[model samples]
Structure formats: C-alpha cells, structure tokens
Target: MSIKLYDLAGIDDRRFSSNCWRTRFALLHKGLPHITVPKLFTSIHKISGDNHRTLPIITDGKTTISDSWAIVNYLEAAYPHKPSLFDKQDSLKSYSEFLQHWSLKAISFPLLQIIIKDIYDRLDPIDKPYFRATREKRFGKTLEDIVKNSEDNVEQFRSGLNPLRVSLKHRNFLSGKKPLYPDYIIAAALMWPRSMSPKQILHEDDTLNTWFKTMLSLYEGIGSKQPKEWVGI
Candidate 1:
C-alpha cells in the first residue's frame, strides 16, 4: 500500500526533527512506496485538528496514523515480511521498544525547541520577527514562553541521551546489528544535534560518531530523491 507522510521542510538543517525523520526512515527501511507532504507546524494542527500535533503523520490507503510511534507500529504489522521492528517474543526487544518510544518523545521535543531558537537567532532581523510572531500565533504562546517551557524540562531531555548511549554501546544498532524502528527513531532525533551540535560533542566518543555517520549514510541511501533543497545535509 502506498503511504503518505506529512512534515515541514525548509527550516534549518538542524530542525530536520527526529520524529519526522524517523517515520521517513522507517518507510524507506521497509522499502515501502510513500509520498512526503511538507507542512508547517501550524498547518499540521489545522489539517489534523485540535490535538495540535506536529508532523509527521502517516496515511496508509486505509487508515491515517498520527504520532511517529503509532505509525511505526502500524507499518510493522502491515508489512510483516520486512525486517521485524519488534521481536514480539523477546522481552529485551519489548523493553527496548518501550524505552525507544519514550526516548523519542522526551528528547526530540526539547532539543528541537533549543534548535528552533538557535535557528531563529540566525535569521535576518525581519525574518526573525516574522518567524517568532508566526510561531507564537500558531502555538498560543510567545516564543520566549515556549523556550522557557522547554528549558524547564531540560533534564527530562537529557535523560533521553542515557538510554540511547546504553543502546548504542550494547549493540551495533539500537536494537541489534541491523537498524530497527528504534534505531531510525533515535537517529531521527539525533540528526539535528549530529549536524549542528558542536564538533566537540559529536566527536567526544568514536563509537557514537561512527554510528551517527552510518545512520546519515542510510538516510541518504533511502531518501535519494529527497529534494536537495529539503535535505539540509
């Protein structure tokens, strides 16, 4: 079945959020035919309704799934012949899947907030005001308010890193040697920091950096037709 994914494009390369990227990566990983539809964060709520959810939402021909985790679950069940995203019989896979779900949620949101603000700072003055105003109107809060909220949850965001670090250390991939749903999920969140994080942080651990580069290479392989303009890399 053909799937459609909705997301926002043309922000900074850093804002290439992991949630959206994960869904995209999963679709590609399964070798599923899919179409990408870019929408601003405001448009996502407008299209999907008051949940105020953001990109990327996936629509299979028969059903529409929001939330990256839900979409991944649906895809795995729908395409069982593909690589198993979840080893239903394995307790470790189940635990890893559970932790991966929360990790994507906890880490990506706050980190994106920080990254978005950094993007805002780099915009030209006129563009900055417009971007801030647009975000405020869409989110029902001033940009400062949003950033403040994210700052309050910084520790929760940091906690996401530990599980990922452990997962990376334990296996070549987050779940195993081959990329699974969690690998794509975590990689999507990490893509932002991987590209924009200080060289010092990215290079701190040789293993982590090597793993990150492998993920990037995988994304490029799958998203070969991804518009050059859309891909910040």
Candidate 2:
C-alpha cells in the first residue's frame, strides 16, 4: 500500500508548515515510502472531503492519521522493525511529550511572531485574505502591527532557546549524536523561515545555527531542502 500526506503548501511548494514538517520528519526517519499532496492553508478541508480540516494528514492502506505526534506514534507502532523515533517508546513517550510541550511554548510562541509575515507573504493568493483576516482576529492586531518589532523580538526568541543551546553544547543532536523527536520538534520549527524568508532567522554565531545545519542535512536534505521558487537554494 502507498502512503500520501496532505501536506501544507504556500504560494509555492517550498512550504513551511512546522507541524506538518514534524510528521514528514518522522516518516522519513522511519524510512517510509510516501508522497506529499500540497494543500493550500485555507483549502485543507478538501483533504478529507468532510468536516476534518488540517494538513499533514496521512493515509496508509486503510489507516488515516492527523496530528504529527499521533502520526509518529502510529508509525512507530505499526513499523516496529524500522528505525526507532522515541527509542524506547514506553520509557520515552512522556519525555517526548515534554519536548513537544517545550517546543510549542519555547519555540513556536515567539517564532510565530518573528515569522508571521514571512508566512503570510508565502501563502497562496486564495489563502491570503482569509489568512490575514482570521489571523488578525485571532491575534487582535494587524499582521504588520504583529510583526513590527520582529527584528527586536528575534533576540528575545533566541534567548528563550537557552535549553536547547545548553544541551547542544555537549552533543551533536538532541539525542546525543543521533537526531530524534526532540531534535525534529525544534529543528523543523526553524524551517518556517528557512522555507520562505531570506532574512537570517538564526543568529550567525549561535550554536543553534550549527545544529540546524546538521538537521537540514539529515535524510538526504529532505528536512530543509524542499523545492524552492522564492529564494536561492
């Protein structure tokens, strides 16, 4: 049976849906055979042809899964003979959850502020008005207003990544020398700007940048090197 991912895409296929990227990272880590079907941000509903709405939706044979963490859990359970993600699933499950939580709070929160416009500018035209208006409503401010001080905010965002930096001081990846769920959670989040914007998101001298380069090189450049139309690759 074949696998297809209703992956999120922007104006071009050089898309950066961080959550979706998490799922892709997991699948590629497990060495699964799959293909991605790009879905514009506002058009994700078409993936299910029902009330279901979200990208990075995957189907293999008769199974369908949404949410990156759940998809990874499914992949590990179903493909036990393949490479492991959590390593010892039962022992590391909660630890992975902790990493996910940390990524959401520490990385996703501030990173979203820094990259909101980059994301908006990359959205398909059909997704623009809705993306802008809905985001404005949810954020209670204009996109321009939201990102006005992003350059200043970037420093603070980098500060909050202290844990990752301190941890990386001794190891090549979050999981010692080998990349794992924790590594993917944080590294894939950085792909937000890597996919769309040319502004250097990571500080040039930060160790995080070095770690991220390694993350990009993983799985034959599948994580960072997507097909690009906006920036030079």
Candidate 3:
C-alpha cells in the first residue's frame, strides 16, 4: 500500500515541524514515496479523524498511524527490506526517549527561545493565535519578550550542543557509519530553526554543522530544499 505523510506547514507552505521532519527522514530512509499533505495547526484533527491533534500522521492504505516514533516503527516492521533507522543493531527506542528528552531539554528548549518569535511570525494568521496562546501559556511571556534576549545568549544555547560535537568528532553520523534515528531525531530539532530563522546557530567549522550539511544533501536535498524565511542573519 502507498504511504501518505501529513506534514505541518507554515504560512508559506514551508514544512517546519521538527517532529514531522523526523517522520519525513524515516520515510526517505525507507525509500517510501509518500504523498505530502501540508496542514496548519488546527487542521491536524481533520486529517487524523480523531480527537488527537498532532502531526506526523500517516495513512498507509486504510491504516492511520500517528507520532514520529510510532510511524518509524510501523514503517520498519512493514518494510523490513528497506534500510533500518535502528541501524539493525540494538533498538534505539529507549535511547530514542532519552534523546528526545535531552533534545527537548538541551536542544529544543534553548533553540525555542531563539526561534519562538520567528515561528510565530511565520505562522498563517489563523495559526498564529493558537500558537501564541499555547506557547505563551507554556513560556509565561510574550513571544517577542521571550526572544528579545536570544541574540546575546544564543552562544550559550549553542553550547548545549557540545555533546553532539564530541560525539561526531571522529564520525560522520550518530549511528557510526550511517545516519539513523538517533541522527535524524536531533537533525530534525536543529532543522526547525534553520527553516524559520535567519541566524547562524553553529560555527561553520563545527562537526555537527558538517554532519547537518551532509543531512541536507541526503534524501535528494529534501532537507535543504524546504524554503527558509531567512538564512545566515
């Protein structure tokens, strides 16, 4: 059965959701050509046919699957002939949770302060209100107020990436020789800001930056082809 990827898109049709990007990378790794559906925040429920209102949803034939990790597992089990996201070694599921939490704590949290306003600005007008209300409630401040100090502190935010830098010092990817879920998980996190903001979040010579460039070139440059509102600002 053919696969369908329900992506979360920005106002300009830019797909920027980190979670959705993870699923996209997994789909590419599996060599699955799926239909891409661009959805705004409020439209998620319409696609899933349930109360659940999140993206990275896929409809494979008559089966509907949600969440990036679940989607990855489903594709792996269904398409065992394809390349594995788990590296065909130990299942990265437990490690994936660890990575997800650390990613949110170390990467996404700091990165969010930098990109939060940018994300708000890029949202479709309809999405802006919901995004702002929810995010503001979560952060307890105006988006602009929260991001105003990011410029001076972006350095500290990048420092959170030290572990990634050290990990990739002698490797091209997190999964040793090839990119895997571990790599894709973090790449998706970083790619979100790249797609929205015009700032250089990493040094040009950074190992993670190099690996990220390689990721952009993978899957036929799907990662880089997505339109960025601004870059290198």
Candidate 4:
C-alpha cells in the first residue's frame, strides 16, 4: 500500500505547507509510492481523529507518523532499500537537523510577515476564522498588523540568507553535489513563500535564485507545477 500523506491545503487546492513539502520531496527522493490527501486547516483532525494540530502526517500501513522530521526518519528506517535520504554519518543527520531549524527560524519565520496575509487570504472560507484566530494568538497581533510594512523587511529577509549564500558558493547544493534531505529542508522553506505569495523573495541576480530554478526542474519538474513569480533571472 502506498503511504498516505495528509498534506495541508489552501484555497483552490494549493499545498503551501513547508513541512509538508519537505515530506513530499523526501518521498520523491526515495522513489516512494505515495498519494497526497489534502486537508484544510480546520480539518487536520479528520485525518487521524487524534486531535492532531499539525500536518504532513503520513500513514504507512499501521504506522502513522507526524512532523516532517519524524516522518523522514520513519521513511529512512522503513524503506532502507530505497535511495537514502541521509548518509550513514551521524554528523550529516545532525547537520540536516540544523538546516531544518535554521530554515524555520531564518526563512519561514521572516516569510510569515510577508506572506501570512496572502496565506490567510488564500484559505478556504471554513478555515479562515480558525487560521486567523490561531495565528493572531501565536503572533499576538492581527494578521494585517503583522503584515504591515512587510515589504520593507524583504531586504532584511534576503540579508538573513547570507550564511546560506556563502555555503552555496562552493557547492551546487547544501548536500554537496546532489540534493538530499538537507536540500529538501531549505527548499521546502522557500516553497512556502512560493505557494503563498505572488512576490519574488530573492534578488534577481542572486545565485540562490538560479539554484532554485534547478530545484524547480528536478523530479520531473514537481516544483514547477506551482505557478511562479520571480524577480528576474
């Protein structure tokens, strides 16, 4: 049986959850057969009836896993015969964890100020109230207020990627020459903004922009399936 990925969705079936994207890429990377079951923000509990507050949950037979990191480990262990998401080196796994947290803090969090409103605007009507309520409580501010002057912070967001930019200066991907779980972690972070907003978060001439294009073309152009709006190349 194919794994069931209960992925988060938005208005018009947009799958914008970065955590879910990480699992999607990991599944694709391992050549695993799975199907996505889109869940609205307010309907994630319907997936497992466990009061699940988050998504990117996968059910592989009797095994149900939540959170992208745990799901990756589950996939790695359960399907050891498939392509490896990580090397045997323990340090690589630690580094992948670092990238995951870094992307969340540096990339995804900053992006919320810019794209949170867009995300709210794109939600299904049934999900809007819950989204607004939960997010307002999380940020302790109204979405409009959080997004106010968001444009002014775009440069700041871009500047925060300096460490990543320097790291990529010497390699084609974060995982040396080939894409790996670490690559998926950062790619998924960018994918969140790509799906939520119609704005280009990266500078036109940045190498990250070029690298992202390559990512869009990978795995039979999976990332390109989403409509893109970049500054320029």
Candidate 5:
C-alpha cells in the first residue's frame, strides 16, 4: 500500500521549510511510494480540522501522523526494510535522537523565521498584506517582529554548532554513513539557511559547502524543483 504524505506543496519548495523537504527526501530515499498532498497556507483552517495541527501530515491508509518528525518516525517503523534511521546500537541511537530533537526545537524555529522573512517579502504586493495578517493571526506576531526575534538568537545558535561540527568531522552522516533521522533533522533545519544565507557563511568551510551541495543534488534527483514564481531577492 502506498503511503499518503501531505505536504505544503509550494511551501515544501526550497524557498520554504526544510522540515517539509526532509520528510519528502526521506520518502524518496527509502524508495517508498507515497502520494503528495499539496497544502496551501491559506487553507490552514481546513487542514487544522483534519490534522488537528498544521502542515506536513502523513497517512498510511490506517493512521494519520502529523509533524515532520512524527511522520519520519512512523515511516521508519512502517517501512524498515530500506534502512533504520536510528542506529541499531543503543547509545548512539539515543544520542542521535537527542540531536534531532535539539536541532528541530532549538535551531529550526529561528532559522525558519529568518528564511521565511525573505520569501514573505517577495510576495506579490497585492497578496502581501493578507499574508502578513494571516501569519500574525496564526503566530500572534508580525513577520518583522518574528524575524527580529530570530536574529537575536543567531549568535547563540551559531555557538551551539560546535558539537555538531565535531560530530560531522567524525562521521559522514550525523549518526553514521547513511542518512539518519538526525541527518534529516539537521538538513531540514538548514534548509532556509542554505537558500538565503550569506555567501561568506556558505563558503566558510569546504566540508559544509560540500554537504549543502550534496543535499541539493539529492533533492534535485527526486523532482524537488523550486518554482520560479517564488524566487525573489
């Protein structure tokens, strides 16, 4: 049976959230057949009624799982033949899970705000006001305020990367040679950064740049093309 993965289609594009892309990539990497349900931010109300949350929900005919991490976990268990995302060893698996959670909660939010601000700014003038208003209603703050707050976290967030850098030096993947849950977590968290980060930051380290290129190449192979309409300065 094919899994039904519901993603915010346009939002899942590189211009949007990396979390969305991670889930999509996981599906592709596992060679799992799934249906893509493209959701729009404007349709949050409808999605909430069905998902009881928001975007990136997945259903396996019998069960519905929301949240990107949860969807990934469900997939790993439901389809374990491809490879295990968590390690077979107990200690490393635990550490990998910890890193994944930390990356998503501590790192992804601020990064997402920074990335989305750029995309938000490029919306058609006629559409901008409504988009901003809806986001404010949903998030309880204007986009500018969110971006400003996110900026405050940048230095501290960068500081927190030392451990990750160390870990990356030792292993090609966050958990091992093959992509794992934490690998997806870090990749998703970096999605926005990869697209909108300053050239200096991107080129600061050869290893990091190579990793980013690898991710982009992987996505490209799976029909994860970004739409031209969404591209903006």
Candidate 6:
C-alpha cells in the first residue's frame, strides 16, 4: 500500500510546512510511493485522530507515524532495500538529527518572523483565526506586531546562514556529494519562504541560493513544481 502523508497546506493547496517538506523529500529520496493529503492548520487533528497533533503524519499499512525525524527513521528501517536516508551509517544519522534541530533554530525560527504575515495571508479563511490566535499566544505578540519591522530581520536571517554558506563552499550539499536527509532539512526550511512569501531571503551572490536551485531540480523537479514567489531570487 502507498503511504499516506498528511501534509500541511495553505490557500490554493500550498504545501508550505517545512516539517512536512522534510518528510516529503525523505519519501522521494527513498523512492517510496506515497500520496499527500492537503491539511489546513485547523484540520491537522482530523488526519491522525488525537494521537498525533502534527503534520507530516504518515500511515503505512497498519502503522501510523508522526514527526518528520520519526517518520524518516521508520521509512529507513521498514524499507531497508530502498535507498537509505542516512547513507546506512549511524554517524550520518546523528548528523542529520543535529542538522534538523539547527535548521529549526537557525533557519525556521528567523524565517517565520520575516514571513509570518505572508503565511497568515495565504491561509484559508477558516484557518486564519486559529493560526493567528495560536501563534500570537505562542509568541506573546500579535501577528502584526511580530512581523513589525521584519524587513530588518533579513540581514540577521542571512547572517545565520554563514555557517551553511561556508559548508556549501566545500560541498554541493550538506550531506556531501549526493543529497541526504540533512540536505532535505535545510532545503525544507528555505522552501517555507519559497512557497508563500515574496520576500527575498537570499541575496543574489549567496552560495546557498545556488544549492537551493539545485535542490529544486532534484527528484525529477519535485521541488520545482511548487508555486514560488521568492522575489529577487
């Protein structure tokens, strides 16, 4: 049976969740056949009952898994014959895990502040209030306030990538030669902004931009198929 992926979506079927994108890229990298079910912020609970309260939940046969890292591990163990997400090495797996957290802290968090309003604008009307309320409560600030003067954050967001930029200077991917789970982690972070906001996150000369373009062309253009409005690239 094909795996069922409950992927988060915004207005016009936009799959913008970086966490979900991690799972999507993993599934593609492993050559696993799967289908995506678009989920609104308010409808995530309906996908996996109350057991899992997140997007990127996957159901394979009788097994159901949530969380991107958990799902990636499950896919690796369940389908050993398929291409490995961690290059069949424990060290790589650990590195991928570290990259996951780093991307969340260094990439996703800052990007969210810059693009939060854009995200809210793209949500379905039904999801807008819920998104606003939950996010405002989480940050202790209204969406408008959170995004206020967000443009100033652009440089901070760019500087955060200096480590990634340096890493890419040595190799085409975070995983080296061939892309791996770690590569997906960062790519998904950038995809969050690419899928919705027109804000220009990467400057023209940034090496990370080149890496991202290569990522978009991978897996037979899977990433390219998404609607993108990244502005000045």
TM-score on alpha carbons, each prediction: 0.69, 0.93, 0.94, 0.96, 0.74, 0.97
lDDT of 5 by residue, 24-80 (tens): 777877778887766556554475485455667777777877777677678777877
Cα deviation of 6, candidate 2, in Å: 1.2
Rank order by TM-score, top first?
6, 4, 3, 2, 5, 1
Superposing all C-alpha atoms, what RMSD in Å does each candidate have to the true structure? Answer: 5.4, 2.0, 1.7, 1.4, 4.3, 1.0
List the global CA lDDT of all models. Answer: 0.63, 0.81, 0.84, 0.86, 0.62, 0.90
Task: Report the lDDT tens digits of candidate 1 across residue range 115-144.
Answer: 556545544444456678877787787666
lDDT (Cα, tens digit) per residue for candidate 2, span 91-148: 5667788898888888888877877887888888898898899889989999999989
Residue 28 lDDT (model 3): 88
Q: Write the number of the candidate with greater lDDT, choosing between 1 and 2.
A: 2
**Model 3 alpha-carbon miss at residue 1, Å:** 3.6
Q: What is the lDDT of residue 75 in candidate 2?
A: 91
Candidates 4 and 5 compared: the better one by lDDT is: 4
Residue-level lDDT for 105 in candidate 6 = 87
Candidate 4 lDDT, 126-175, residue by residue in tens: 99999899999999999999989888889899999998889799999988
In model 2, pairs of residues that clash are none
Per-residue lDDT, model 5, residue 78, is 80
Q: In terms of TM-score, which candidate is stronger, 1 or 5?
A: 5
Q: Candidate 4, 122: how far from true, in Å?
A: 0.9
Question: Which of the two candidates, 2 or 4, achieves a greater TM-score against the reference?
Answer: 4
Per residue, candidate 6 scores C-alpha lDDT tens digits across 137-202 of: 999999899989798998888988999888889898988999999899999998899988998899
Which regions in candidate 1 have their CA more than 4 angstroms from the true location? 12-15, 46-52, 87-93, 101-106, 109-113, 121-163, 194-201, 219-233
| Most accurate candidate by lDDT | 6
Error of 2 at 194 (Å): 1.2
The candidate that wins on TM-score is 6
Better of 2 and 6 by TM-score: 6
Model 2 scores worst on lDDT over the 10 consecutive residues at: 224-233
